[model samples]
Target chain A: MSFPGLPRMTGWRPIATILILAGAVAATARFAFGLGATTNLSDAFPWGLWIGFDFLGIGLAASGFTIVAAVNLFHAKEYEPIVRPAILTAFIGYLLVVLVLIIDLGRPDHFWHPMVMWNPKSVMCEISWCLMLYTTVLSLEFAPIILEKFNIHAPIKWIHAISLPLMIFGVLLSTLHQSSFGSLYLIVPNRLHALWYTPLLPVLFFVSCIASGISMVILESLILSRGGRDYLPTPLRANLAKIIAVTLAVYTVVRLQDLLARGALRELTTLTYYSLAFYAELLIGFVIPFALLLVERIRTSRRGLYAASLMVVVGFAFNRMNTAITGLEQYPTQTYFPSLIEVFIMLGITAVGFSAFSFIVKHFPIFEGAAVAPGLHHTAVAAQANPGFLSPDGGDLEPS
Target chain B: MSQKKAMLIDVTLCVGCNACQGACKEENQLPPSDEKYLSLTAFTALSKYNDLYIRRMCQHCDVPTCVSVCPVGALTKMEAGPVAYDGEKCIGCRYCLQACPFHVPKYEWSSTQPRIQKCKFCASRLAQGRPPACAEACPTGATKFGDRDGLLAEAAGRISAEPTKFVPRIYGRDDVGGTSMLYISPVPFEQLGFDARLGKTPLPMLTMSALSKVPNVLSVGGVMLGGIWWITNRRSEVQAFEATEKKNRPSRHEDNP
Candidate 1:
């Protein structure tokens, strides 16, 4: 029998592919004609939906790296099952961010100038250099999985040697650029509305990235399990929930402190949409998820866990957009609803992320118990029966 | 003649006529200010204080924030005290736009291949030792362009001589770590759309404070990762060793076998 998670096609493949192609075409048009030709960006709103969603969206989707590092590198044996898939998701999410950057740039050809002509004073220069370096580091971190697919063994041993340094580098690089993304707006004090403009913006951005990344890991795992993939080990899923629970609690407290420090709490008393959004971001995104994940019963139920994770992810996305767009938009009443082409382009990039992830999982030795169970069956029965639909390697044939 | 230099804008001396705006377009060979490219390079701004025409341009600061943040050195502060741009070197990252505390750098975002467009402080005119177009075209002596030291002393002398006519302070003297272009307003500087919160500190210093943490974060992160890796790898190795030793041991009843 075929694996349940494997694409059965059922005729939906053609439709998905066509939609993705349309998105790619629109994205190309956006780049060729200039941002003004497609996007609704302006001087008041220099960064529009693409930078807001694609960069911040994928950056929050960064849970894959931190989760994998937490489990595998740290030997959190309880988290092992989720590690490989998390890394795969992170790799694709990051690649999409780079793709978005290329499109967003006014002069995409000169994008490489940051590499050779480094300006130490500019945060953008630092962000540019770090992003490129970190992408390389991530690719290296994901190499063992790719190598395993081809049955390559000798170099696999060296993976351990480089893994430690790379993991450290990955975490450091992620922190700086994620924060630097906030620093990009640090100088825009007057233009950026008072609500989002604070000296603590960078710190707030970093904390939110951590909280959102953990939330994303939990969400991805829940979705994968529901899709009837090789099941996530119970222990690993629990560990992810616990991480999300703790991080959310911390994020909530920090966000409140920041608001208080900036004396923004007074503004919340006004019965405006911004005030409502502020409370909603806190309540749904952080408080609710943290409380639910803490309860053992909620964590144990598959659906409950899935719903909580999904809410947190939505909450995180809303929070980032609220700061980047909605908060700033209130100043001059400038409207910036994404055009149709812009929406399609974002959807297309996400499709690419999903497709890349699907291919990687099918080949890699991502699941731990998948290989072991079949071998045990052979020894117990003394029958030369075919291990039905087992991969050719007899073990969970690791892809490399 | 060397390109005319210096735009001495006397905010106190005249009414807000927009002759300078028209002259700047003509001098720079720029098109009329359009809605699509509503940049400060050729845009109009009605001053918040008493509706004075605040013809904004490159301030040419002593410590130019634009110069500091231009990743490719596309924007450089010349020895003659003008901040100049090299379009060929501009990658158009627009950090210079964000970094400029005075909010001077503007972009041609409407174009597919946009370049940063900002006031050059009439560097070309300065090279020719001619008065800048705006100051020259100004019908009143409200605007002047001269040597940096001369301007500062002149500003100081004016403030002392006519304290009642102008505010006690000179704008841009200490704003954003000081700029060559000085402004003497009758009203408060904040009322004129100037950012008063920008302290005596240079903008680049704030960014450097954060970037300095990079090496520290990396070194500490490296050690922590190494420690975790060692523990995980060690545990598995010990487990494997135990398994091999267990298999080699003799059983109590199978000593002869």
Candidate 2:
């Protein structure tokens, strides 16, 4: 009953299993019945929890492009240890978004409509193309890791030949869509409240995702470190913290400047539901994380880094949720909370993601840089010719 | 692309009758429901502010934001004046529902095969040389249908004819780049729940301003990345080549000895 790739049905892993089962059932009921029966979405609020989750997932998964661009494109080879995990996370993150999209779509069957039907004018169209194309590039980037396990060298070499271009294209696609998520709301300037809506939303979104993306990488390393191994060295994690701190600082400055310029500062001074939510989001997502990371002691400490990254991720979610839901709540005059079915379905998809990540990591060379294939998994001896990429930064990548 | 028809809804003349709502439901073949606000079943709904009854329907902007934001081109601005919805083409991402400034588009969330439901300006009847069903059904002539230019002029004429009786502004004349539906009210349009601050520029222009920069990003970004990759990798290649040459070169001390 055991498979090499599947997680053992023990510990908290079983909860994920149960969730996966429940989520699949809920998904079936959703498609079988309708969004109204499953979700609290109405004419007043067409997008709800799922759309917010899409932003969160995409933002957090930003590590894949950022890391690859640094190592493969800029030749920053010192940070190659977490490359496989970052790529895998991005792959899972995107697929999860697509899954939620299918469940969220009124016509799951017509999800392909965007593929054949082109509307270049629409930001959504551009986002759809980028999502698909970037996923392909990620596959190429991560293919060698799996191919080496199976001892398949030909495609690995082919993939390596075009690796630089592939990584560049992936980064470009990521930049477009990550910002386009914010652009999606630009049309709703009237509908979205003054507190959240701004002409600089795209820039804000793009910058914030970089912070969250790096935080995600840091958080992943810390979380897995509990299993008795430092997923990333302290120096490396601190280096990443420095990046997050700088990104958050830029985000804070831009946001403040924009708010001041628009004369929306008065709205913040007034006590209202929206102002409170905005305050909370800024505090959790930006202010707190920025200040915490500024402390050299906290930045280098495992506990401090953990708290900071966790705050960044939470804050990232808060900002996106507030932007997507809370800010738009006033115009609609109707409150929306996801139904039990909706909540379960979202949880299940998340569980499935975790399960899939564990499964792939167990079988593939994700965390470890080894190309070992014990027992029957080893297919051929292409070790010398295998497209194992060395440091792109040359010798400057050595433990500095 | 054709005649460019428009509807002028004079709120002052409206008598709080729900006949237009009824007529819209009947024409679209939606289930009969006297909904208080816009819904899947009611394409046109009436909201009362004291004695004034306001009609809510698709503003059908000339540069419809919904049309511009639809990834599948499901919501389209027709050749005539109506903004049409093609259900078969709809992936039902609900971008139209989210983007509409008027909040006119409603979804069939209760149906498995949900499509956006909105007022289509009775496009079929317009093809048959008739006004929209709502315009035709209005008992007090509150809703008038005609060529867009003609309606603007007539609305202008009415405002000046009895400036004291009207707000003296056509609500949709310049708002959001001129919606197909025009409005003239006794009081301020905001009092009637109209978003007067939607700006004179079309909403699509906001997104387009960002999207327009995509080409520049690609070309400039591509060249810069390629150049960096070359320079960085070339330095590494040169360093490794020099290292090998140092190892292979004959020793000067051995030659002297």
lDDT of each: 0.69, 0.85
Model 2: residues with Cα > 4 Å off, grouped in runs? A1-10, A331-333, A370-400, B32-35, B249-257
Best-performing candidate as measured by lDDT: 2
DockQ of each: 0.39, 0.55
Model 1, runs deviating above 4 Å: A6-15, A152-161, A363-400, B1-8, B32-51, B98-101, B231-257
Task: State how far residue A128 of model 2 sits from its true place (Å).
Answer: 0.8
Write down the DockQ of candidate 2. Answer: 0.55
- For residue A357, give model 2's deviation from the true position in Å: 1.1
- Displacement of residue A145 (Cα, Å) in model 2 is 1.6
CAPRI class of candidate 2: medium
